[model samples]
Target chain A: MTQVALMNQVVEWVNEAADQIREKLKSPIMVEEKSNRHDLVTNVDKETEAFLVEKIRTNYPDDHILGEEGLGDNLSDTKGRIWVIDPIDGTLNFVKQQENFCIMIGIFEDNVPILGFIYDVVKDEFAYGGAKTGVFLNSQSVNQVENVCLRDGLIGVNGAMFCHNTFNVRDIAIEAVGVRMLGCAGLDFLNVIRGKQNGYISNLAPWDFAAGVALSEPLGLKCSKFDGSPYDILGERQYFLVATQKTYEEIANY
Target chain B: MTQVALMNQVVEWVNEAADQIREKLKSPIMVEEKSNRHDLVTNVDKETEAFLVEKIRTNYPDDHILGEEGLGDNLSDTKGRIWVIDPIDGTLNFVKQQENFCIMIGIFEDNVPILGFIYDVVKDEFAYGGAKTGVFLNSQSVNQVENVCLRDGLIGVNGAMFCHNTFNVRDIAIEAVGVRMLGCAGLDFLNVIRGKQNGYISNLAPWDFAAGVALSEPLGLKCSKFDGSPYDILGERQYFLVATQKTYEEIANY
Candidate 1:
């Protein structure tokens, strides 16, 4: 694969998808309940996912795709060049606030993450990068987040999990200065990449955090399964990403 | 007091204070703990309070003032024209996220709220209003919100209060589609007034919620004490605001 060439196409495709998302938001949205009333999906989510899938398939016909809206391939293994996309990461937020929702894309080649993108459509904050190059917020190259301790920084938690005290989230929340539930996984991790938030703990799907892991590692951010094990980009699991090693260890105590 | 003239001047003062706040956030902040590490106050908070206090005193010397930063008068009674200012409403948010914090101003005459302003400086979203006229987001007039039920719309909750299940927040949270914790009372209520959130429940001080009452009443939103009593802007207490009357009653059940 031509690494830079593939990255360029991904970036272009992301911007195009973002523009389409803004256009779709202008119309009255049609929402449907998914797993429950709390889990939602809009026509825009499906349409956006289809758009991304079509673009990838047309450009790289041999590539495999897994998507939130299920408009792509049904695959059990991450064997070849594969793409995972969440066209609208926070559909409920989009329906209610028309804000904070984001579009995320992650590309893996032979099970190794190669490219990633997270676009906050409302804020026009595009965070994208890969392991070969450091992360970039918009156009500027970035570094790791500040090493703020658990007692000093604000954290974003998965609201449902926190409410259920999954992984003892209530205890972790208490150790942190404050908790924020923005209701969007992509935007929450965007805050972590920018150093605005110290960490985010959640039970996420592959599409929910693939882009985040792809963009985070280059910035020295640690993405781990809650037990401090290596994170698998292909699985749906509980995960936590911390700004620094100190915060990672402190949070693990809970 | 010439109510219109005072309102215009107050808007001007609020905007000027917001400008200074943006400037201060760019520099290193000096944060001090208040009630706990979770409760923070910054030098910028004190300076901004002093700035607003000086402006009010110079413009209206006889007016009494109650402020979070303690840069104004300490009169216990709420008689006469008075102002309440929370220089930095989400002090911890300001110190950590550097976003979501707000400068809130509520002015009252003889225990009746007159003018209120909630400036979300980072987003450049200014929400202001009073009893005579309707509420406005930025410069556009806003309505009383969607009138959606607790089961349909999003709700903003105070982080610490939710953690403690204060007012049975966990139960209240379950009744809603989702929960958001923006950290700043001004920003939280701003979401409520604009129809983005159906309700917000909190244990807020007078300064933290006085401006919200002043703005919400004009939009016909309900602001009540936890026991379903009329909310008093002059007193600090537990309160909730709802978009629809049905929701108002439904939330009270929790």
Candidate 2:
């Protein structure tokens, strides 16, 4: 099968994984602390990751995987076909609110992102596409986001920006119409894709952004390091911002 | 009619007003800047407020009304039955996202809050009731929110907290698991009422919080000034915090 054909199937696989999560939510949740009390991992996240890994190993055995929940193979490089998966992107949101969580998957071919899928499990809005298929929101092709400037748009900022006052985020809030934090990167990315938010910026890991970058590339949006550098999609926790070209330029100058 | 019957009727009125908004959403949305670019008002807000006032006056003309959009009577005292209306709380969310906005109403009897309604218009989740009828989520009686301490629970902070770091909010984020900002008080208040969040704090005007204060009262949550003093609900730009009993005390001490 062609790469696009394979990715069409990958979207279905993502939906199946979302089903597993919704099923797990029916029972009492069992949570375990990951690095500390602030960081958390739950059984559903592990289970979902296992499900995706199993699907990939069965269908595309040669593909390497880098996943958050340790259900995938350890890989030294993003060579050949690498699938970066965040089975449950916002576990804290899942455990606490049972909302604002999503499943994100980005499949790369020889270090270039070819397909991306982000399923907002609760709202049932799936954003999927690639360089070949173009970005889609629930099978509908996504149009170009409006070029709203900083003063006219809402921006998403993580806790660090507020707590540390980084990038003058406090003043940015005043200069911009407002700022919001949804506690989930996928949702923030989705908002930017939908033109509801001008941009989303965070110090996030590879899996947290690969799918978003893939989806955004075809929509005429800019996905780059916070300082307007090229996105190092394979790198670990890095400052990232996805936004419209105008907003990106404005923020870059600011 | 008894107070319960009157409140039930008020809930119906709230629903009627919500239906009006849902209908108005089909047409083109008209928005006007209020005071500044950061603040906004939409045609839906004025229309919803007019609809509710018409309903109230048609049924209970003796009652005075205080509303956010300046569509109601001006009363010196909260004597007699008074209705507080925020036709579109989070107008920015309404105009930008159309998902997070809500309609809020609080009914007071001789300066005492007796009934409250917060309808997440798009989600169709209607939260209403108060001290006499008990708090409710879509006609279902809501139980008490868990008494999670400030450290263990998620909290909601508004833009001012981040901009000014007031109440040591920057450090407060470190003390709690994390924080979320929805840009909509009704939604944040709904999260707390659903036990998804421990509390919400903001510098707000009278109409911004009157309904939330009424809805939270019966849920065993404390509604107070951020300093833990009694809430002066009718005041403008007062610091308000609503939370579970334990969380409230901890925030007060912190």
Which DockQ-derived CAPRI band holds candidate 2? medium
In the predicted model 1, the residue pairs found to clash are none
lDDT of 1 at A103: 93
What digit string (tens of lDDT, one per residue) describes model 2 on residues B1-254?
Answer: 88789878988888888888888888889999989887899889998899898888998889888889998887777679888899999999888887788899988888888888899999888998888888889878899888888888888998778667798876666777879988999998899988999989888877888899888878888888888777765567788899889888877876
Tens-digit lDDT string for candidate 2 (A1-254): 98668868988888888888888789999999998987899889888898899999999889898888887776777679989899998888898899889999988887788888899999898998887877889889889888888888898988877667777666665667889988889999889988999888788888899889888877878988887777765677888888888878877876
In terms of lDDT, the best-performing candidate is: 2
**After superposition, which runs of candidate 1 have C-alpha atoms over 4 Å from their true positions?**
A237-243, B236-243
TM-score of 2: 0.97
DockQ: which candidate is best? 1
- For residues A1-254, write the lDDT of model 1, one tens digit per residue: 57767777788988998898888888999999999998999999998998899898888899998898888787888788889899999998999999989999988887777778999999999998888866788888877677778877888998888888888888988888888899999988898888788888988888888898888777767888888887676666556554556778888777
* C-alpha TM-scores of all predictions: 0.96, 0.97
